[model samples]
Target: MLTNVPGYPRIGSGRELKKANEAYWAGTASLEKLQLTARQLRRQNWEAMQQAGIDLIPSNDFSYYDQVLDMCLMTGTIPARFKPLLERLASPQSLELYFAMARGYQKNGLDITAMEMTKWFDTNYHYLVPEFDTTQQYRLLSHKCVEEFREAKSLGIHTKPVIIGPLTFLLLGKIKDHSLHLHSLLEQLLPVYLQLLTALQEAGATWIQIDEPYLAMDLNPAIHQLYINTYNRIHQAIPGLQLLIATYFDALGDNLATALQLPVQALHIDLVRAPQQLTTVLQQLPAGMQLSLGVVDGRNIWKNDYQLSLALINEAVQAIGQDRVWISSACSLLHTPYDLDLEQDEQVLTREIKHWMAFAKQKLHEIADLAQIATGNNTSLAANMAAMQAKQHSPLIHKPAVKARVAALDESHATRKSPFHVRQESQEVAFQLPLFPTTTIGSFPQTAEIRQLRAQLKKGTISSEEYHQRIKAAIAETVKWQESLHLDVLVHGEFERNDMVEYFGEQLEGFVFTQNGWVQSYGSRCVKPPIIYGDVQRTHPMTVAWSSYAQSLTKKPMKGMLTGPVTILQWSFVRNDQPRADTTFQIALAIRDEVSDLEKAGIRVIQVDEPAVREGLPLRRANWDAYLQWAVQAFRIAVCSVLDDTQIHTHMCYAEFNDIIDSIAAMDADVITIETSRSQMELLEAFARFKYPNEIGPGVYDIHSPRVPTVEEMSSLLQKASTLLPARNIWVNPDCGLKTRNWPETEQSLRNMVAAAVQSRSAVLVN
Candidate 1:
């Protein structure tokens, strides 16, 4: 059997791409330097895969921004809005034009907000949403996949070029013309895919990995049939070209039969997520069709259980000969960190915990080793087996106190004191703000100076007291600025916090920090998700002091910000020994402790950000109910400790909550703030149709981009939102936190937002 990886991390070990991209954006580096950095990273990635004995290395997966955006460029899916920007640019083929589409462009009197970005599947990674129209044409705008394949060939590596499959691409996109449906463009779309495939065939590429992860989800019969037709047509068109249909993240239950019937050379199924599917796959797989058993967990940070994975792979090899079976990761390694050896926290993460962990590079080695073992060479398996055996008996993994606490949890621990309406009335009396209360989604900007101070604190160049003083000063300035804007609710500007989840993880017992484990969240914005190792417990108050201090400095209501249990669990590379729900519940209880402490310290308004909640929903609808039950319960467990008058607010960003409206209401947050600005109030339509009982803060400013919305634009969005729900039920805010943005844009955008809210409220009163 051959060893393969679906995809690899594009960000360099030290986030070299991030630094180079930022330098280019800031005019500190030449475009040539930026291109050289990208080329270097790509070459390094190819070389690493080749050296790891990967027979099927993937090319064209190294995206500067996102694969979805790359597909948009490749297929000429540019929206009409970006036409003016392209026309203004001297060179239309400039990467700046492409970057402008991913991130908004604002310079030299040209201002354009970027296209909307949403979470990719159930991960923290965000993708630029593809916008389509009736008149949209399809052509090979960028031969990125073909070019990358040639580059790899030049390095003596014959790699399989990866492309986002047609059906999945179409499903993720939206139609601009309300008169036409998204599927209607498939006739024009399919031809472009054929052209690209034919080009790859001409370029001497033998195998192409077409990722159709949507097949893993519960699909209607028609959509399942659509996949049969789509792949069949492509198969007939390119007779000699081999197509490998790749599906992961969940099991293909009903779609399994449809997938097997497709005319593809090979099929890849994730055994890590759905091991039960292995027996069925072995039974239904057609004669002479190759099977790629994805036995390694790609989305996790844990060491693969060599005994179990090898057993599964050996079963497949027994059914289909070893020549026809390939070994690969369950998903792309894009979800993991670089290398475990690169980790810095020896004292905290520890040798024992590190022994059981494997980052992306280590995972590649495991895949290689598994291939070797399956081929009857067990040299690498000996140490892996020993480590796995030792971990099973480790005392660090089994703690009585954490188990006792989890067993002690009851129904009462997950219930609030009152219903939302009663809580709303009391909260109204306690705060007494305007019809449209204006607030931020927490986190004012993290400036260069703030980052420098944090680095100083970490390096011991500055004392802890000095760090605290600087953070306090930053918070004071943010408070004064918000008050000047006449905002209703205020935040302390999370200057001391590095990340929303990482900050809380640092205060918790079971979590550990990394020095250089950054993963790309979106564009140049990278996040280092904390590693959750052992049983979680909170010993002391996490956010009380800073929240209490901020409230004391302000007359307006101050919101104590905390990352929710679900978001914390979803964002972090959590321990895989127990059920995910159990780990999530543990994290919830810890946050509950923090919530009670903050309420006791006089924080009347609290916002627990659960932006990852929707993103964490199971890919299969059949599995969503079970996942949501515990996920919602976890959120309730975290916030139920606070009184109704405390006004629990939960914030979600870059999510499509239409299908999960009932689930969102189930969380029972007094006022739920959603990310709607990028959608231009399109997301609010769900709540509008549902007539959602809870109050909402529908974001009016798109904080994801550098472009600041004009007062009129913000007012128009508020006007539209008011028409959807009662004006009194709607609050005004930005789409998400201001951490990724600069201070100037954050301030200007908030100023415009507040003014719009004031104007809209006045108009509502007039009506």
Candidate 2:
């Protein structure tokens, strides 16, 4: 009888939050105005959920930036580096701390940088990494949970507040000082969690969902014991509050049996992913414990089969009685798009294929409907059943041509025209460059003027001709800057793109753009993921004009930037009715056309960035090879369309490549760049172990931080990299693109990068 929706979308239905935040950051909008906009959006969300008949609506799920960062601020887990800035500003509220943690702060004397952010559990969503040192302490900042609960109550809506579990928080955090193990910090961190839970309890929150998704991972014995100990203490301390320990994305596996015995009120299992675990789970369910069955897929856009879902709910009911069963989503809907109702294009097949569809709003309705049917509130589920049946039988779900092409895909599509050795010989004769050539990872800083111009173009305030001219001018200036620095392999600055993926999606058929379908990719960063609604094909060239124009401006080999096929599929709200391999192959075919066109346009270096390639991997390692097979084939299909002498390059961002080193080599890119500065070239060991033969550019400096790298620092990093990699196989670059950095840091960092490459070349000669 406990119907609930997982986390709600935070980007705002109309993307009002993204616009307001950007405007405030750019000084175009006032702080008061941004605050008012977020408050209004929150109210609208609460009202909408209330009208939808959601039994246990969630609060504190709405984040101005990131919920994990919000948790850090709420528990007073501020790093010492940020404390002085908070003191200098003379504003020490939770909101101030949260924003400072997200955007960072620099006044006259005090300089504080934000914590390092990385992807959240293989999803595009990012969480701020909490910092811990020897003197780490805990205190409740502003009672955020209590405040949000009170705010919702005043609006006549009682809500269950959500908070990140202490175990998961520590699992995601970093120990900078290295004085304490993770378990040591938990003792100090747990008191604050206890305090916050007590406050929420006092504030009349009957239930709280403690998100410990780390339980789903392969945990060590010590960590497993720690989870047991931590929950025992919390359940004993906070006896009044009903605790729902939610584990998602995959089954809890060995942890499931132990987790079921924990002293919690309810156990939320992801039936959509691990439906087989249901029978085993039901057998082990304690007499009084409730079951929150996550029948709706939270991470994807697939519509639930109402008939199938009802049968599963009935099974749970028969196994554990109707009173003990509830319906929910497999994970948080924060990963999903905002509302499907806003997408107005009838040509977008996904919109019309509503049976294979459910956004956050629709999922809530599904939960409520499932709950009603279980409670005997409705007799006939025929209408919803028929709707689902029609969707499964739709022509849109299957395309014979697409299916045939994928089936006929051979090893030749996954292989280059020639082997790496042959390609390398040809590329060396063609490029004729230095031993340690330097280049950037495509984009430069996306300035406010450029953003405004894009916004204006989108709003029809600027003509396409005028916009094209402006972008060309920007690219010219950027090329000039790179030439002045005397760097090799110049990029066109990616001035024409709003995002790497969105740019290609605009030119590709079977993809639909959304004006307001924004989803948070990281702290204060939102991406409007294009929806792949049908069989994809490239209508025309996507990046040829900009690459051609930049090449015309400079004699240096300009790199043609394209988002790889796997990344395009990963980042977009892809069609779920078909296997992802089919979608990726379709995208690969489209990008293949662009690659051939760019090569013909005289762009010798093309960097196809597959940053999200690792994100698409299945959580379980057993299922990795099948995913990697198609993923590598997609990359090969895209890049093999180019000539051997064209010097095909691929870039990966913030991924551990140890397991996939062979697959990466299998892709056969002429050159590969990976993010390595953060891990201190530890990631490059994979290349060394695999004896990876292709050229590599292990990033010489971390681009995420604002701190300018000295030439010595970058030189040292390059030296360390040379020890792990063959000097002949090395190139020099930053960890990722420079879009997130300011002009000052971007220029300084690239200068140091070039200097380091020079230093590296000299050192190799002397050795």
Candidate 3:
């Protein structure tokens, strides 16, 4: 019984990659230093897998930024805007070029916007969306897959090179040229995959793991045929080399029969998310295909169930031989934290709750332990069962009061006092303002001094009162600056907080923080997701003091910022013991308390951000309605507590909202701000088509890229948005938060954005 996994966490336990990448980007560290750090991290990851008894270690799964972006550079899917840099910059500066593509180029007298970015499938991790044109061509652009495979082999490790499958790569990317459909690039992308596969074969690779997560998605007959033809082509081209097609994050569903027809040696399915699909897969499984049973939960942190996994492995072995049955994590451990042992502080995740959890390192050991237990070794089963039993019976987990409160809640709790039209009128009276009101998406740039203040408070070097004063001073500076910018609908800049979700989770009950449990959200951006071990409750007002204080600073309407219920639930390592919807409802109740508190404190406007709600939509369309029902209910529960006169705003980013426009409308927020600049108001088209009644702030400036747009550029985007939806229904804003940006770029971008808005306003007045 061999233990296999599709991928492991690439970010180190301490986030060494993040620090090094930031240093290199800041020019404080050399390129050699960054490359060395990357190599060291890769070696450590490979060694960790080897030590954990992983039979099929994965290489090329580690990425400097994102694996999809790597695939983009590999397949010559480079955007045309980088042609000059590509031609001018020599080979040694390839890493620089890659970083330029990931983060847009702002220096060297060039201002190129980075490619569009969005949620990768249904996770917090973002990937750069590859842009394709009508004249797209594919070739062996980056030999990173081969280079990495050989790099690992140099250290005496036999590894399986992992690459995103061609079809999935094509499916995930967007077509920049309207003349091109994504599927039309199949022929163009195939030869490059063949070339790469051939190179891997020549480099002493026996097996290649081609990740086709697209298999788990909804597909029509045409797409199914695409899969059949694709695998057949690969099979004919490289007969000697074995290929493992890994699918995860969902069940194969109706595509199971079609999946069996593919010419791959082995196939992996996500048994964690969709265990019921195993019976169907076993029934339709081809004669010679190896089955990888993904029993260990990869997307979560909960310890694996030994008995359940052993039984599934036994059942599979009974159907096929033991040699053909393998155990692995359900999906990439990229979604989870790197290590759990780092949570040494007993004040955080206590020992009792820690026993029932597993990070990436623990998950690897769980995979190995499962294989060992299935093969007549029962050493670890007793401990696993003890932890499971403790969790089931623990007073820390179950709360009758919380459960009763949820049960007592009725439909009235999830409904606003009035509809949007009525609320809009009340809000207009509440906060009198001009058209195209300008505001940021809550946070301003988190500067070094502000971070130092928080660090000092944590370390006990600064008194609580001193820290409070410093935060107030930072807020004062921010408020004064926004006033100078002549912006409307101000925020406190969220200077006292950390990550949007983590800060709220810290003040709430039933959620545990981690000292070093970092997971990569994107390049150089890591988040430590709190663990939801028990029933949630709000202990105190999370942001009322800050919002009230900021509102006192200015006569203008100050928006109260909060991480909405769905986003909190989606971002956290939620408890597996109860239904996710139950936990979300608990969180909603908690946020509802805070919303009421803020409104009571004279906060006229509130912004509850549900950036993760769209990402939380079920992968299969069949399951979406139920999820959306609960998701929308949770959001409504959070904001509906406020009066109709209190203008409630919600912000969502990155994910496409076209399909879920009804649900978006169902959230019943008075205003919705979305990330649209990367798409050049393309997302606004959906809202326009849907005739979304509420006010929308189609972000005219791309905040993700550091390149500050010219006033003209932003006005152009505003004009584009106005043409789609009524100009009266539009607000002016940036795409997302400024937490990751610097003060210089953030100031310049906001200044340009304000100029654009004012320019738009002047034009409208003239009309």
Which candidate has the highest lDDT of all? 3
Residue 726 alpha-carbon offset, candidate 2, angstroms: 3.7
**In order, how many clashes per candidate?**
0, 2, 0
How well does candidate 3 score on lDDT at residue 574?
91
Global CA lDDT computed for model 3: 0.90
Off by over 4 Å in 2: 27-34, 83-97, 104-107, 110-113, 176-179, 345-356, 377-383, 417-422, 447-470, 677-692, 700-716, 740-752, 755-767
Question: How do the residues 177-205 of candidate 3 rate in per-residue lDDT, one tens digit apiece?
Answer: 88776567888888899999999999999
**Candidate 1 residue-wise lDDT, 1-767, digit = tens:** 78889999998998999999889988999999999999999999988888888999999989888999999989989887778887787865568888999888888778888999998998899999999986667788888899999998998989999999998998898888888764567878899999999999999999999999998987888788788888889888988989899999888888899999999999999999899999899988999899888988888888999999989988888887898899999989998888888876786467777888888898889999999888889898889889888877887666678778888988899899888888889998999999899998888788899999999998899999989988998889889988998999999989989999999999998887777778889888899989887789899998899999999998899999999999999999988778989899889989999899999999999999999989999898878899899999999999998887898999998989999999899999998998888888999999988889999999888887778889999999999988899876899888888888887777788889989988998898798
Pick the TM-score winner: 3
Q: What is the TM-score of each candidate against the true structure?
A: 0.98, 0.91, 0.99
Clashes by residue pair, model 1 = none
- Pairs of residues clashing in candidate 3: none
Best of the two (1, 3) by TM-score: 3
Q: Stretches of candidate 1 above 4 Å error?
A: 89-92
Put down candidate 2 lDDT per residue, 244-343, tens digits, no spaces: 8888888888787668767899888888878878888888999999998899888777677767788889998999898898789888889887777776
By lDDT, is 1 or 3 better?
3
